[model samples]
Target: MTVNDKLQADWEPKSDAVQRDQRAAYDEMRERCPVAYSDFLEWSVFRHEDIVRVLMDPDTFSNAASRHLSVPDGMDPPEHTEYRRMIVQYFQPERVDAFEPQCREIAAKRLQSLLGRDELEFIGDFAHWFAVRIQSASLGWPLEMCEPLRLWTQKNHQATFAQDRPAMAEIAKEFEGYVHELLQIRRAAGAQASDDITGSLLRQYVQGRPLRDEEIVSIVRNWTVGEVGTISAALGILVHYLAQHPDLQQQLRTQPSLLPAAIDEILRIYGPLVSNRRITTRPVEIGGRKIAAGERISLIWISANRDGRVFEDPEAYRLDRDPTANLLYGAGIHVCPGAPLARMEMRVAMEEILGHTTRIDPIPERPPTGAVYPGSGFATLPLRVR
Candidate 1:
């Protein structure tokens, strides 16, 4: 192959067809070009085993892929370990269980609002609403912050997809502004500050010193992004999946206890978060393709989890599938610290949805629109609920 041919993009991740249907596009890339490159994502890793190799060897493939600070998500080794240890406290079983009542309450309130509305756009009306509400409650933020946070997430996604450096920097600054205001409020309160997660972060110390304001903001920013963006997309995907599959929907409704496993399996079939970034720490060959040191990598989660080699009949929903192999919340040391909270939120949301509604069907005239690139799941999901 010529030098130009070897270096040229094997596939366009941001192309129109791929954006319309990412899972299918990634499936094609996995077979046709397992280690594809594009200007947008640099190197896109498709297969399950190859992605797993990258995940297992964080030293070789670093999580510090972005130029901006991502708190624990962008960190590795001793630094990642220290911050992750502190961040994980918020998602512990007890903490998650403690937040359950409130999560259900938020879901119930949302469902109540949708009552009697048979046909509605589920994305804005419910998914984003519930995600932000639950996130606000968990972080001790006022309900007033939900709309702004949701809007911020949308802008963040747009900037990320376009790779607009200036906009992304401004967006990051805007998020930091939101976080700073919260910090100031708690700092103003002194000893009387509410004993919630945000307040807890203020008190948290790392590396033998109290957390700085920027670090705290970065931490909260990561949490909010995961909670608001990923969870909202995931809810849309889950509800849309159920609306399309009558038998699975019926089964889930009949056995309410199965919602958690059903939720995982369904999400596995159609993942929410699209891809995560990694950078090659040294010259490495992935899937027989030589990648130079300092090159960027994109681990396509939606594609990796659905790999036919690792998963027999990958598209088929199976509660019996190996849980260990699923990269939904990711793998290795950088595995999402908020996974427990996310799973709980999804389960609670589904339980509330299924328990309240007798059926869920998609609106034929208004087919669900798929979210593109950095986002996953339906951008607009019109569902008929009864």
Candidate 2:
């Protein structure tokens, strides 16, 4: 059945109540209505078990939720397999290790600038720039593209939240234009094109055929959005949490080696990503709710990771929890291929921040603003760093 045929709102996803505190709101939903239907988000699966069921049974719940070309992200099975293979190679262990030094340099430089300030809006001043810089550097994009890309990410979030299809289409076109120009330059340069990730993609092939310009744009768009939006939100959540829990902050500061695990745990507690989309290929019953074929389903990562059934003391910060249970990078075939890169980036950034400063405390008068639906973490994180 089509969206219009659906009746009875189970919950309002875009409501002020949910947007005010998404984690709490999702936690309530997990217990109240694990599988719910609404106009905004048709079927939101909030329980850990239900989401895991969806992730594992991709045949029943398809990832092809978008009409636009989304490369592997919007594909399934045989098609998804080939493109996923090509995407994973770019983020192999060796490649991620090679990029660490540059990532550290970017983090260190950004941290140095903010060290002198007594108080600053962390998201705008530091987090966003770090995400944008590292993403551009990794892709070998021109330095001039950084600001525009940052602005584009912001606009993309706004468009998504508003569910403004026309604005989203325009934003997508804007990104395509940037990527197409880069591809054109690389093609014109031929052998002289810098041997970077972007250049490497130009040489990549799929199904015994060269990738088209639109495909390349789609891939790059996915990477950029994933990197910029999620990383920025993750950083805000990490620093904000550290500022609140001084004990964990000091622990991580002394034992920098524990950063990788700590970052994962913290992100799991307050997921950087709000939700991932999936469409039911056929009718399926989950959490005692019967969802029709072709129904839109959203796996609420924020809710699933915090479910007390799977995670004991769901709100508490503990590094000893089972890593396998954490859905920070997700699970199953569609798990984030860039998990390694994201982990490295977050680890390095946290290390630099903790090493550089003695304290990261929240401002008493100005509390950090929680980011609304379609966004995670702080909208403006005001903190004192010294």
Candidate 3:
């Protein structure tokens, strides 16, 4: 069927029901209608098999769903290939290794601030701050930019959830302004520019030419948004999950070596990222649903990761599951380039958190508040730590 013919809504993405508990809602959608249609998301592919198919076939399921330029994330091959080459170098093993100390220091310091409190809101007191500080430190941004970046991330999430195109554009422009000023300072410094990620971006070349200022801004914006939002959510999810499962928490705390695999398993059970967008380049059929060319598609990462078809007893945490099958960082050519950095950051954060505290318990009187659409994990996670 063509786009015009399939006009009925299969789900309400913004309804309180779905927003209140997205994981459960998505799981329902995956089983009932794997390739479902909605006005807000256009077409949401909710199953692992279908999402994997789209990820593998980028030519047919193009990532150029956004009207705005999104550096490598919103670009398809040839263009995506070239820019990805330049981008990947920033997150190389050596670069990530060098940043490990700084990442841990930030995490340690943030955890110290929350230690005295008997009950704390983990998201505000620690998770968001760690995300902002580490991202700034990683990119050589001024510490003063932390608050603005945090507020900007919040506003960006609100704008995205509302699907406010104008607001999103204005927010993007605001981010561009911040990046442009940073670039200008570096340019003025000439040879004295700080030898950091942002400064080095000024020297990067793409297709035999230096990257444009706007392109640099786009790349930085993408990284900042990705790093801040997802890391914060992941931390909250990891902590909240551990608080509920004290046995698992104690096990991980006792054997810190199990954290890498444990963290991945927990996040797979509860995804940090909600979804990613794609556009159909040609007529395609997924899960017996027909979709036409030029239609927008949402690859529901949260749902795909929890699909029982691929993950047996999908909600149960299992460390032995095939790591490659877990779509935590995604798969195929456009998989997250910063996965290594993100993993390192999370592991360090957890290590410091678990090591510093003897126990982490959820405040039963003040239950955690789940973040709404476009955002995942707990928005207000109250935990008692000691």
Candidate 4:
């Protein structure tokens, strides 16, 4: 019944299989051993309750699990809180509202451009393109920079997940150069009269001192590396599901007020984030298992979303499900601060697409390839726009 007992039971593949199929694998583990450990990746906390507990108590399950990938966002409370507050205001409702119309316009233009095409790959043609452009514009980056940034971000992620050290070093050098150039430009221009997110990050300070150059680089890298691909993946999932369920789509079209709830449901059903690992600072008991200090603990968000104990009809997607129970945006203090921005983008996108097209359906005989971690989702989601 304990974690050790479960570890003795059997070993499961955490990474080999494609993520979509891994849900069932995680569920099986949750039932047998919620706090499962592997020699390769430390312990995997699979249950909703267990993952939530760890998220809430950062002292016990420290966030400084790993340094390279875990940014300030992944650090523990006092430290995490400071970094978060530095820019939380930029994602406030008013700021999000200001960006909403722009987001809607972007979605409309993208949809218009691809309208009437025989087939359209939503991931590249729509999702990646829209997400990168919006992110670039939001931060006051040059419009021309979006494409190159997108390419770099993709390569950066690929190299990291692949664990290719040489490639990572090369890409990091390139990224450092890019951020350095941007920093110089901002320094020369002084503070502008605009409220752009990047400008705020540049002008903002912590503890009465400006954020260091490397800190700025880390922040921008995390934003692009963390957000863009996930948003694209989420978009692909949304389009895939919507295409499969014409009735639900029709209902949402008729009851457009349901768009927000529908988006929440879609994210809950197939959220972009997969799992994140944290290290134990001391021995802790979880799901009747004893996890020793210094062991890696993976909080599988995607698995928790499909947890049958917490969700009714866990496999089925229901738009009206209560949002309180969802783990899609994560939990505790480390929960995604960019959630409001992501929601705004998603809502505006769906609203625009539905307004212009009679129906959005999937193209049969062509399924997109799954992304490996640090990224996942459709390589090419060719959908019928009409």
Candidate 5:
């Protein structure tokens, strides 16, 4: 397909689609524009191998300043390494284990509340709400703060797709102001930091000194804002898929032991976090295309995860698929720090949903994922439950 054809398809979802099926269009782009460049959006890398190479070789395709629109995860190593190390423990296995009961409780409570509703917007009601609350509580933030933070995060995300820098800047300022207040309160109260992730960060002494207020702000921004939306979006897509394939849902429900595997399969099939941007620090050739220094390259994770080069049946969802090779959480040094936690939340959420309900079906009339990145899903997913 032509570039305009691809752009048209990609941009189409912003208006017409559910935000979950952008993969077909992106897969087409990977074949057509493996190293495609846009004067407006820099380079776009679509091939699975090429994306892997970039993700693995952070020194060349540096993430130092390419994560999101800011400089936290965008900063490259060894600084990024330090920051990652300092907070990495927060999402470690044991830490995630500690939050399990809370995750299940939140999911169970939400499911209970929705018990008899004929229809519900799963994204707004359960997926987004539960993930936001779980993440907030995990970080020691008051559950009451979830709505405000959710609003700010949505505004910040919407601003990214905005064409004006001034508008994005204004949103950034607002986000910073709110985070700043939270940081101050947490510090002044000299509150005994709870044994959770946020508390761990607060008590952490990076480089042998207490983390600075600005540093704390950066960590929380990266944690809270960067996290919730993707998980919610992914959960919405997973739920929709499970609803459509009742047999698969049955398989999962019958063998709850299969959930972890099933979650990985679902993620591989419909990874919520779509693309990550990387800048070329040096000229390089990838997938037979020359990429010059300073150009932006989007590591199309959603496309890569679905590439036939890696997955045997790239488009099919198989619960039996081994997840070690999947790029859903990405690969290499800059891989997502919160992946373990996300997985934990998803497993618990799905378990609760499956345990409480027998079957789920997509409404007959629904939108498709056309061109948006990370595929927004389910404006509303109404399911019939027991």
Candidate 6:
């Protein structure tokens, strides 16, 4: 709350305009102030080039932006590399491949409950439900944990946006309790423990030492809450995007193989996750703004993915665009390790929806509600499923 910092504020991220339309606001901000400042998010980097620079050079823009432990995603250098290698096996091709049938089963069951309905609220009724169920099933969690995890994701987002450190800490501790209980269950089971991801984590070792409970909790938090939030938002965005774009929807329905590529492209155009935080290790200039060492900044993913400089006619949908340029799963050492599982979950969920229904159309009377900062996609998506 220094005078200089207050004076540097460029735009209000939670303004009415942004709340109404996040994409349009981000597009305008990226153009007007590529390196904007705000009280909420110290310095916001909106351009694709600047974000790519930040990602490629993690040494300069460190990912240890949180005060709490964040497993591999929020660590730096040597430490991140070690933890990353240990946990990546959970998302190996074989593991994710084995889970595909189960993922489809979860999606199908949710759809079956609403099969006869003409109109539905996709966000609450389907998107969040499916996201939580899939995450729970992946971890061998009981069906009862789904509702709690879904609610935890919501509360986590609220505390994050409000910058309520105490509330955030409380929820963090709550998540730790959940993980602790699960770990204890596995431990008690001994030789009969279910060999799921959660059980596997209890047996993981790092740097010649068994992984501590705190470390295990951090890892599960990154995988569960993070994936649940993003995957839910992503599914909502995909369904809403297809409903608005009939040509693409129909094309995908006919050429089902294109869904894998189509899902990434749609999410690129309308990102599910908003931004990631990084801190400066040394003074540097990005977008002509000089940032001092120890300063925190946000790389706006929603804006960066749609930067016209990188993707020609960035807003337009196209399959031919270069995949490497897209920062969907991010770039560099901190890139999302669970991308394989996430990709499979989304593809399977979308395939089930499209395969079972002939059309997904928007209800004229009930427009989708745009999620606020720190959360992307719709909060309430009312659509006609036929």
lDDT at position 162, candidate 6:
88
Q: Which residue pairs collide in model 6, if any? A: none
- Cα displacement (angstroms), candidate 2, residue 123, comes to 0.3
Better of 1 and 6 by lDDT: 6
- Using all chains and alpha carbons, the TM-scores for the candidates as numbered come to 0.97, 0.98, 0.98, 0.91, 0.89, 0.98
In terms of TM-score, which candidate is stronger, 2 or 5?
2
Question: Over the full model, what C-alpha lDDT does candidate 4 score relative to the true structure?
Answer: 0.77
lDDT score at residue 27, model 6, on the 0-100 scale = 94
Which prediction has more favorable TM-score, 1 or 4? Answer: 1
By lDDT, rank the candidates, best first. Answer: 3, 2, 6, 1, 4, 5
Please give, for residues 33-106, the per-residue lDDT of candidate 1 as tens digits: 99988877788999999999999999999999878777989988889999999888888899999999989988
Residue-level lDDT of model 4, residues 1-386, one tens digit each, is 53454455245453675344555566777787777767545688888888898889889988887656444765777777788898688779999999988888888988898897968888888988988988887877888898788898789877866778899989987887887887777777776534566656777787779887777877877777667877787888887878889998888778889888887788777757778778888887888777777778888787788788889898787766768789888888888888899888887887887788888877668866666665655667888777
- RMSD vs true structure, all candidates: 1.7, 1.0, 1.1, 3.0, 4.0, 1.3
Q: Give lDDT per model, in order.
A: 0.89, 0.92, 0.93, 0.77, 0.73, 0.91
Comparing 3 and 4 on TM-score, the stronger one: 3
Tens-digit lDDT track for model 5 on 1-386? 43223332223323333244466667777776666655445567777788877888888888754434432477777777777887777788998998899889888988999978876667778877886898788877777788887787677666665545788777767767876776666667676535555555667775679877567767787777657877787788888888878898899898999887777877777777777778878888887766667767777787788888788888788755557678888888878888899888888988899898887776666533322433344445655555
**Model 2: lDDT of residue 49:** 92
Q: Which stretches of candidate 1 lie over 4 Å from their true place?
A: 1-6
Q: Residue-wise lDDT of candidate 3 within 1-386, one digit each (tens)?
A: 56756488999999999999999999999989898888888899999999999999999999999888889899999999999999999889999999999899888887787799898899999999999999999999999999999999999999999999999999999999999999999999999999988999999999999999989998999999899999999999999999999999999988999999999999999999999999999998989988899999999999999988889999898987999999989899999999999999999999999999999999988999999988999899999999
- How far residue 2's Cα lies from its native spot in candidate 5, in Å, is 24
Tens-digit lDDT track for model 6 on 11-102?
98888888788899989999999998888888999999999999999999999998888898889979999999998898899999999999
State in Å the error of residue 32, model 2.
0.6
Q: Which portions of model 5 show Cα errors greater than 4 Å?
A: 1-21, 66-72, 191-196, 319-322, 366-371
